[model samples]
Target chain A: MERKVCAHIQCRLGPMRLGWHGTIQTVADVIKMLFKEVYAPSGADKLMFYLAPLIVLIAPFIVCALIPFGRNLVVADVSMGIPLIIAVNGFGVLGILLGGWSSNNKYSLLGALRSGAQMISYEISFTMILLFVVMISGSTNLMSITLGQEGTILDWWIFKIPVLGIVAFILFFISSTAEMNRAPFDIAEAEQELTGGYHTEYNGTPFAMFYLAEYIALVTNSALATTCFLGGFLPPCIGVAFVDNYLNMVPGVVWFFAKVYFMIWCYMMVRWTFVRPRVDQLMDFEWKFLLPVNLVLLATGAAYIVIWG
Target chain B: MSEYIILSIFLFLGAFIAAAATVTGLLLGYRTKNTANKMAPYECGMETIGNARIQFKVGYYLFALLFLVFDIEALFLFPVMMNFREIMAGHTPLSPMIVLIDLAIFIVILVSGLAYAWKKGILKWE
Candidate 1:
């Protein structure tokens, strides 16, 4: 009788059966594949190989902890928040380099080397753009920077500095996209050329670690951009009295997540829209174009702050 | 500090989550006996060739070196940037003009190095 009832229910819910049962089976298969030893590292330096995924897994979360979700809702409100973020993110490159080198595959090695070069190169412009924000806001703390633009949308850094603000935001956006190794700047993991790049040999749960790290990094980068450029957690106060009051009633965290998600959506669009550039062209774009332009913008931003203040 | 404690806790949580996933995969997944071909580094289904760690061009190394010099320079400029408002407010020892000139000079030197690299064709991709 129980078997007959089970068969009847299964037949009745046939379309819905795949939804839950299929998902569980897929999860089980993935778990089995993850545990199967595909390529075991056997050498004196085997310990370092294991450290790679662990670092990649945890570093982004550490960076995420420093980001302020709301006015006073940060996990760690360090004084040197921006610099701390830049410094901790540098460890992500270490994991990629180690994973690639230890994989004992040619494609992985090439991908790892490219990743190192790409990240270090873009990080210069990335930091320079942050410096412009620091100079304008006059504080290394992200909370103060966000608070500096609290009153109105016009007060935000993107609008506050006129042309320089917009230019800096664009430059920061580009460099950060490259820094995160998304789409156009993802020569490190170019599928046609370098296979899977640094994590080519990775599989199972270890591969998932790198994959999760990349998404987490993407979220952190977009959130930082939102906090630094857009007014962090500030609602659009259009100066209309009732509308402003209504918008303000929504919690700051909601506003923060809304803006961050919008930025993430923009990033996803860019990733899907553009084709990856050649490695040399990628380097050329940074050195010949971005670096020089950013330098000029940095000086201009400094002058703007000094002359206007 | 309490802030550092929070950061450490967050870090620990991230690690714990990652470890749990990996351990669960290991414990629940079926283990198959390793074979020579199955364990080899993948090369598009071809037999493994010579080691992948062969020497490439030195141009990449040169670019990284240039990046290092400028990155350090940017770090040194952070203090000047952070203090711009204070200098302008007349709270600092240095005047705005003096600070601006100091920054201009530092930038000029860095720019000249970049120019040198360009002139030497080190920045050239082809």
Candidate 2:
């Protein structure tokens, strides 16, 4: 799907051979990966090298449970749902750091360090944006958040909070993209510079684990953005009777996935569009700029709630 | 709550699946390549240098320091923000002014710390 989007945007054939436009390319890649040599470096720290992939792979899946896919489709509607999701995903960086360190390879270690700083800095902004949503929604419960935006389209958090809502949404998008280490922030795995970065020494299933975790994190983060801002599973009602009724006829799960896939498409588009920033530039943008803006947004969000309420 | 149980189970399931896939790959993967290059660390196509464990710069550790401070601050602010609406509406015995003023002071202090880091060039990369 990501390749297909890249092809569409760039005017080229993406995956024409394997399945319909290379739809099953991923399946073929997995099979090849499974049969490939699972090599372990002689100089590597055996324990950590083996453990890092598991840690990285599990973090995203655990967070997936907290996302409310539909009205009642959530796996674990924990009380601390929002904060917990961000915190759990934080663990992925640990795996990356460990993977790089244990690989006993220069490129992997450097890649890990770069990604660690990028992810941690962006995470502060990411959490602040989610806190912005929680401030508006009044509770961290994922269900309440989804149900709170029950009215027309304007009632959604993105439109409901005026200027700050849209601003927070965009900030959330950027920070989450960075946190996931996708294309623009993908210097960790920069093909030319790092030569596969942290996973340089990994092969077979372990490497596949990192690859799968990346996409899983993508879906989890997109679902989070959708649930927090776009109104999870809530049909886009334009305040008219006929249209609203017809829209409601479609299941909330369908709408939920539609929004998620759309957010994923948006991610892919941004990935293919921009060039990655230098490491110093990336850090400066976060600490000097994004963090301060987010802090101010938090202050304004508090003020907005006090006055508007 | 049952929710917590389900979450734990989900976590274990994820771990199990990852472990299972890895084991499956080990069982079925190629074993013929026993060359010294296969066991060596990949530093592009060239031979690797001395060791991968060189001393990193202090800038990396400084971010960790700042993160720890802000992350701990978040742990405190979260509970207050979560119930800020209730506190303002007189649901609690405490006055709303006390809460707002406290939050203002906290954030002001945090931002000041950040500014000090910025101006001192602690944020600058070597």
Candidate 3:
């Protein structure tokens, strides 16, 4: 009885202590510890070490600005949306390369080199899939693509083009995973091999930046996928009167995020479920399997467009 | 114009967030002088060894070269893709058959090159 009373008092006091001052103090302590880890004097080049993480963190945010969350709700509706996204994302590879090289560590350098090669190989298929989408959608603007699929579930690119659409969606999904440096394609930072890959020497806020960049890229890629293939912000309605009427009541923005998070959930599942592929297997898989399939898919998309139109 | 302005603002905001995090860490974190051993490259807790940087296989460079070729070829298809609707609508002088045949030829050449690389064992990692 006495122990139970003491426990009750302790739980109540714990909540009171954690309300305000406790929270602030904890945050301050964390900041101090983070700074200590980050500011430790190291032999690596200071400029590249710092700059690379910053660039990687920021690049994804900038790329995401061009993505349309809802109609006219985009931060920037650029004409060259697809190309711009590709260009900005390409900068992320440079940042990784620089971070690895500047660390003056062998493991970091190898990790960086692997990242460069992996990104370049996957980018070929990535671009081809985007081109295929552009061919079918008839515009490079993301907004237009979203609008094109505004009708119903059947109008979405993933279903509209039959076999080619599904193939492109799968190809895009895989390549985007590679582009974001997520597993099983994440050979660059395979911990068993490269000891944290490009960010081996990173700690503190610099490491935080790399972490931030990755999650942001995941969210942005999901949004890109939602926009390109899954009928961005379009609720499911198969030309039914009641369902269409009911679904349209919910805001497009909500639909947009719901779909985006669902895709993000899928990515999380994929990351956890798969083991990392060997580096040679990764290259061969891309060069032999993904590359050829994407080439054929692109051609099929083009032929379909010409023959049908 | 406004769109570019928004994009610039977004970029600036990202940079600002990154700088703030780093600065906060720098200001709050403790600083210590580096010792020779402390500054040395990490090697799984072993003593100093030879340089970590060594020549890698030529296969990586070869893949990079091939990537450049294929990527550029893919880019060339962009204009044709974007204008596909126009060609189909009979708005342009180009015929659908010519466009289809042209893309087919380009893809055929690209695939053949891939075949050559695969046959040469350049794609093999081992």
Candidate 4:
């Protein structure tokens, strides 16, 4: 199964290990291995270039499976679902790098390099935001976090304190969007500027897979945001205490998806409505703005609990 | 629990449908040809040239490095956040002031790193 392939690769090549190895174990290596035996480089031989991209495109969806929707709905409910999701994303980057490198185009290579930086940069804050959520919820189990928000709207972490929660929500949303390579943050594949970006040379099913992965990731990030800050399945009203006890009447599953798609709609709005920022501006906004703001918010949340409790 | 089950079911079904669609498309759309031209890397309708991989700027690597430093530091705050109530509520002899001071020191160290990176131009967009 594709899940097995990802797990196998994920274990031997997790982010920390892969980061240390750098470009040696990247997509370029994958292509080189494939072609090490082949001699000719022309005409009908050009078709193999399509295979790597196709595989890359389809990858994110498989990883998305591991992301739990509710208490029991994930493919593999590893306690570290958050890290698993992040690792899956890291794998998605290698696919892009390989697709770009294998194409043997200058533009594609440049695009891949840009994407590598952009991904590694946003992932830091993105991972930090998840850590913040986990800390507030007091559990690494994502399902427990969603359940903690069950019943009342106030149960949601965002509603626990208006200003800090909202700020955290906004920060999580922005960093996740950039991490997923969506619009406004999708400079890696800007068609007019980078000529279709990293997938420039890909075609056929390989291209289709990468295309599918993008949309799937868009949905995945939305689902994660829904669960993390917006009260996964709980409706957006009423008292936390009242809902927590009685909301169990309706199936938790339904509430879970209702929240997930609602978040997806919000993501779609940003993707379609905004003009993309330049790469430099995106990095500046993250390092200078979002990171610092989250730090301050964390401190505030800590202080709030300290004095108020 | 039912919620997780439903999600897994939906996920598996979605993946199955996608795979089927992909296999069907591959069968229907792509031509099966045994030709040398089809196997070569596409280079905008020309012969492939030069190594595609190149060394990247150290600045990007610096950003990644800086990210790890701050990220790990942020994680240490979690235990403090969760156990703050107990620690302050006479669970441990440490006073609230002590906890706050300890956290302040950790954060100060983190911020100083940021300042160092900034002064070194590692955070610069240029």
Candidate 5:
């Protein structure tokens, strides 16, 4: 009974009373508390793997909340919105490495290495795509870009540039998917070969948070596509002067989310419809195709901005 | 602006709380239950071990190199599509021809490299 009192204080009772005594210290009545003293690993081992990834994965989405899709639906309108996102994206890689490393498994280490290489490769191309859009719109602030396309479908970068628009969309989609470690690019989480991939060793709620972080990343990536490439929160045919002006009645936030989810559908389709390539093939695709093409695309966009804008 | 500020704060706080919980759990769960024999880097549980970080096959590196080449190529076409209108604006009557020819050249360049690699059997799975 005296030992039970010490347990109630919530102090670390390592190896004190075998396993039975750990179960008696609950918050309820002493008897019920006694029954509740089901002292498991207290889930500390699993928790050790979650904190870094949670921050890395969730921070970018938080920034996305500030990026307005339409007229008035942004969280914060920072001038360097695009740069901010890039930094956030870069930051997420650390959490991924930490998760893989802290798990302390060979497969996890390999997954981490693969993830690091893949993310860095794709991030270059992704940034180029962002720059392409920013060049066309003449602003990095998502709101300004939307406003630039406010009164016309033709004003949207997609219609304005044609081929480059398609390229940018594909680049953004592919690179972001790679960044999120979705299938076809999800070599990091290849279950058949790598066990559970990076976090295979993780158990309990820590694992759950990692799962949540992935979903959050998917949502964040989709929202970014909407804001950067698709006109955020604007109707498809709001080109007419009167219609665009009058359409202001609808809240911009709703339209922003609609565009975001449409992109999410695109992302899901990619995941569902494809088989993952071998890691080497994935790397080859990135370095040979993504890097050069994005470099050219960046140059072309820059040239166009200088010549036309 | 204030709405934006509040939202940002909320997001940061949420992330902070989640991070704190995870860290706390990790700290509590850390243990050093090492057995000296089990702790070594797996010499099949024999006396000791050789170099742990053994080199993989050269083919792996070659495959990675090829991927690097192609991924960059794909990125080049992105901006062309985005700014096609500006480039083809004044050449409207001649636009489709120009677009077709430009893309044809681009595709041909990439396709040939793919063919070269394929013919060399670099693309074959071992």
Candidate 6:
């Protein structure tokens, strides 16, 4: 879907050969991946190499359990939703680190090192922004956070607090994009530099695991953004009674997924328009620029509530 | 809690699905004749050089250290941020001034350390 979106954005057809405007291309790719030869280099640490993809694949799976899909559709509506998500997502980084170390390749090592630093640094601001949301919502539970954005669309977290909320939301979008290792912040798998990075040695199913995990993380992050900044599962009604009633006719789950996919589409749009930064420049941007801004934003939120509330 | 139980199930299920997929691929995947060249580590189409375990820059280690310190602080700050409004509204037993002063001190110390690190050029890649 991302590829198709990118292709159409560039006024080109993608996957014309596959069924239904290449909708089945992903299935074909998966089948091809499963049948491909799984190769392990003689120098590779076989145990770690095999374990890495599994660990990477597990992070998003666990997060899925924590996120509230709709009012009552969540798998696990844990109280520590945001914090646990941040912590669980770190496991993916561990998997990449192990995968790179076990591969025993210079490019892989460098890529892994870059990724570790990049992600760890950006995560500070990411959580800070999440903390900002928790402050506004007054609860750590994901469902509560979503419910706090009740009423009109303007009641959403992004618009609830005037300048602070949107600033934090934009910061959240930027850092979350970086957190997921999306393009523009994808120094980890800058193929031009690292030739597939941490998964450099992986082929066949293991490579597919990494590939699938990236997409899953992408969706998971977008879903999180939808839940946090946008009004999750809440229709975009502007306080008109009949209109709101009509909008509510559609299920909340539909609104939830629609918002999630819209976020994903925005990601795809931004991804295709890229200007990759030097590894050093990228690090400086996060550590120096993003972190301080996030801190100030949090302080502003605190002031906003104390003064206005 | 039952949530923890469900979470554990999720973890095991994820790992199991990943393992099952890999096993299925191994079972169905065709083997090719192993060549020595095919088994060597990639080095951008060049021959493998010195061990990949060669010395790396300390900048990454420095960043990791800084991250470890800050990340824990952020975690500690979460609970405080969540209930800040209620506390300010005198819902909690503790006075609002104490909480305010504490957060101010916390952020001040955090920012100063960041400034110190910045001045020392620890964040610089070189």
Judging by DockQ against the true structure, name the best candidate: 6
* Regions more than 4 Å wrong, model 4: A1-75, A236-249, B1-29, B32-50, B54-56, B74-99
The DockQ-derived docking category for candidate 4 is incorrect
Q: Supply fnat for every model shown.
A: 0.61, 0.68, 0.66, 0.25, 0.09, 0.74
lDDT of 6 at A35: 96
For model 5, the superposed segments whose C-alpha errors exceed 4 Å read A1-50, A238-249, B1-11, B20-126
lDDT of each: 0.81, 0.89, 0.82, 0.67, 0.64, 0.89
- Model 4 per-residue lDDT tens digits across residues A221-290: 8777877887775556575567655666676568777877767767766776688998888888887887
Q: Write the per-residue lDDT of candidate 1 for residues A2-71, one digit (tens) a residue.
A: 2222334455422233345343544554556577543343321355556678877778898899888898
The DockQ value obtained for model 4 is: 0.22
lDDT of 6: 0.89
Q: TM-score of model 1 relative to the true fold?
A: 0.90
The list of candidate 1 runs beyond 4 A from truth reads A1-45
Estimate TM-scores for all models.
Answer: 0.90, 0.98, 0.89, 0.74, 0.66, 0.98
Worst 10 residues of 3 chain A by lDDT: A1-10
Better of 3 and 4 by DockQ: 3
Ranking by TM-score: 6, 2, 1, 3, 4, 5
Interface C-alpha root-mean-square deviation, candidates in order: 2.4, 1.0, 2.2, 7.6, 8.1, 1.0
lDDT of 2 by residue, B63-90 (tens): 9889878877876788888888788887
Please, what are the lDDT tens digits per residue for candidate 6 over residues B8-77? 8999888887888888888889898889888889988888887888799988899999998888998999
Docking class of predicted structure 2: medium
- Give per-residue CA lDDT, model 4, range B1-126, as digits (tens): 654564456545654654554455555553546465665555566766655555657777788788667656655665565466567565777887888898889888888888788788788877
| Poorest lDDT segment (10 consecutive residues) of candidate 6 chain A | A14-23
Off by over 4 Å in 3: A1-33, A40-42
Model 6 - which docking category?
Answer: high
Error of 5 at B89 (Å): 18
What shift in Å separates residue B80 of candidate 3 from its native position after superposition?
0.9
The local distance difference test score of model 1 is 0.81
DockQ of 5: 0.13
Tell me which of candidates 1 and 6 scores higher on DockQ.
6
